[model samples]
Target: MPSGPWKNLSADFCGPLPTGEYLFVVIDEYSRFPVVEIVKSTSANETIPIVDKLISIFGLPKVIKTDNGSPFNSHAFKEFAENTGFHHRRITPRWPKTNSQAESFNKPMMKAVLAARIERRNWQQEPFKFFRQYRGTPHPSTGFAPFSLLFNRETRTKLPQVPTYKPNAVDECARQNDEVAKRKMKQNATFNNSPNDIHCGDVVLMKNEQKNNKLAPNLDPKPYNVVAKKGGMVTVSSTSGMEKNVTRNTSCFKRIPNTLAPGSVEPEVAEGEELILERKDEQVPISDSKSMPMQNAAPTLAPETIPKSKPTVQFSDKRTTPASNVTEPYITRSGRIVRKPAVF
Candidate 1:
């Protein structure tokens, strides 16, 4: 949880709406309060103004988390972050769970738009009404309304209520509720953890998520060496001597068994030294093989033990014309052209 309201924020672009406008959404990590701006574009210029306006109303946030979209990755956004004195952090590509606050809000926000369209109401105006109700309602995790958590006052709504002013009590209650909710979520999710056998330095094959064909293996054919393991995330480096290094959730990698031990380095062979292979119960030196007698060699298989070879069938040469005066081309019923092999 954030230290205070507006300290940590998550921002995301929702869509090209019915009017072709995108919703720039900003969510407060602590309060879960959202501020959305329907804009013509999601460029850095448009995003900066919406965030700047929000910063003026609420204090400047310490950190703003967003996906690696063009707006967030642009030089203009970087400059804005530097000027505003906030760290602009980006979530992992293709992973939206890192920015859970904004992503979670987007579902309901879109649902409100859809609901409005079905009811024959203005879609644009319906989101503001939805936000009002959402802000006033008590959150499941926090057990306090977003408006109350952010402003330390109860929001006015259609429902009748007695005005209560206890900012300290609200904060304490929200903190306890948040902790309890997080604990329950973690307990339920612990079963999906990475395999215990996977460890640092183990050889692993990553999941092939972008396979082009059904015949492709589920895991990548190329093996990678695990360099680091942190909780559910694993860092792997390419073992094929390529400069590929990636960090992904542990579930993405499949461990290889009966391979080299972790942190164990193979002894390097000296230049011009041939690699030696030793067979069980037979200690033979490959370099000294020429000196060994033929009598010491393993016995050849008995005639009966060897399988008999099939008789070879000879084909007539193409140059040798057929005995009959038939002038038909050689062709199979399936339309395949057939020709007799020429005798050398």
Candidate 2:
């Protein structure tokens, strides 16, 4: 947990708005003090400067949390993190709640923008106004205004108030209240109690984060094989070579039945080929010459096939006739008659 404001920070992008601008929001994890920047793009080049400006104001944060977005996952962002001397912690893919601070702030910021859009006011100006109001107001979790927590002083807002002496118990009170709120939140979330059932070697389906249509299913239909598992993190390799291997939280995966064949594609039959279906209960005798493959058939085997050596000598097709004194003949499951020889 973050011990104080600016120790830990979280960031996320809000949009490509009507004006084709994106709101790049960064918030101090402890104080919930947000710094909003209207970026032309969410590229690492654009975002890194904004983050550097914030660092200039608040000093470098120990850790910066973000989602597995392209900007954050890029090599440039990685180099930026190394150069800036801050740990860049990316949250689980497909799970927004992991970066709750930035995600929660995005809601009210969007609502403010929507309000401005409806009222025919400047959308960009309204979100900053909303941020000012949010900073002055008391946060529900910590019971302290974001400005007060960040600066350790009373924030002057539109509402008139007598300037009073700042209390020294602010940090202690915020910590206690934040801990209680977190405990309550944990208790209320039922998923916190659910066990991680996914494991290495399990065949699974990932939660599809990028759905092109509303009709798309929540979980991807393509199967993946769990190549590794470390605590809650799972490394899955796509069974169908279409996608690259991805490492994500176990919650992003749904364990499928082991019977499923990963990346398996059914072979297409050629123009003159016949499709043969076999049943488990039906037994074809090896001695039946008609059931044998054509002598001149291709020697190459399918990937799943296990080759067996041919017999050195072939058996005769001729069968011995049953004696007339034989009592009775036994019938097998496949309706083949078995004649027993008379006892000496």
Candidate 3:
């Protein structure tokens, strides 16, 4: 639980409504009061404005918790969180339980939506009523109504008319919340937490959540070496030298038993000064084109066949010939051939 209302808030998207829209739900961790916004598109551009509108009305939260959704993970949202001076906590991928409060809230909210749909009621108006009623009702864990805790006053409702009741003191509610949280933490601590404490150099098979290819397995068959571990995140380098940082809870990585302990045997190094596949001055011909560059292969065009030059045929200017100097064979008036003039 948060120390105060709106200090720690969780947000999520619940959707595919009848209209194919999504509901962006934001809830106060301590008060359990929720604010739902309808969104046509979940893109960062669209989501940031909606969240900004809500945050403007209510003061900024110290920490904003969200799942690894596109809008939440987007650069725009990250920048928004930075500019607004709030810590953004992204829950482990594929593990909604990491943000249990948000996930739990999503269930009841969706159920109510479905029920309202079945009844053919005015669903758009239902969220407001639901939020109002939920705020008024006392929570089982907190033992105080969200409205009373948040506003320090009992919310007016259509219930039976009675005298005004005083709200629970904030300090008293906080103390009670701390105690309940402590109890729950102790209960959860009973479960084994060995996976959470991964050490560097540990070989683990990280979960494969990437679904780009359908044929890929769910978990990596090959083991990866853990290079770094920071809180719930670990940086693992695969056997093929690819490295990735993944959430500890989301990956659910398991250790692979090693036959040989690390550093027990010195890794093999090339004994000679030269590497096995090192390039040499001497070029040895090989049958395969890949092994060698095919130096002896036939050239595209043979040297002899390649014509060095063509015979030059220089011609006098054909246009300079005088038409008058040219002799013309002509038919005479009586069909006799005409000849060059004797005087010429």
Highest-lDDT candidate: 2
Q: What TM-score should be assigned to candidate 3?
A: 0.47
- Tens digits of per-residue lDDT for model 2, 94-185: 99999999999999889999999999998878777888889999999999999999988888876889988655687689989999999899
Between candidates 1 and 3, the lDDT winner: 1
Q: Give me the runs in candidate 2 sitting further than 4 Å from their true place.
A: 166-344
Expressed as tens digits, the lDDT of each residue in 1-344 for candidate 1 is: 98898899999999987778998899999999999888999888888888889999998999999999998999999998999899999999999999999999999999999999999999889889999999999999899999999988899888898977655886899999999999989887776664467898789888998889989889877778899989888999987668768999888988886354344464554554533433344222333333322433432222342325422334566353323332322434443333344333
TM for every model, in the order presented, reads 0.48, 0.48, 0.47
lDDT of 3 by residue, 1-344 (tens): 77888899889888878898999888888988788888898899988898788789988889989999999889999999999889999988999888887778888788778778889977777767677878899999899898888777788888776767654697689989999999999678656444354688887787776767989987766677787777667777765676555546524687765544333354444433321221234222222323321234321222343335432333476433222433433434443334453221
TM-score of 1: 0.48
Q: Positional deviation of 137 in candidate 3, in angstroms?
A: 0.2
- Badly placed stretches (over 4 Å) of model 1 are 166-344
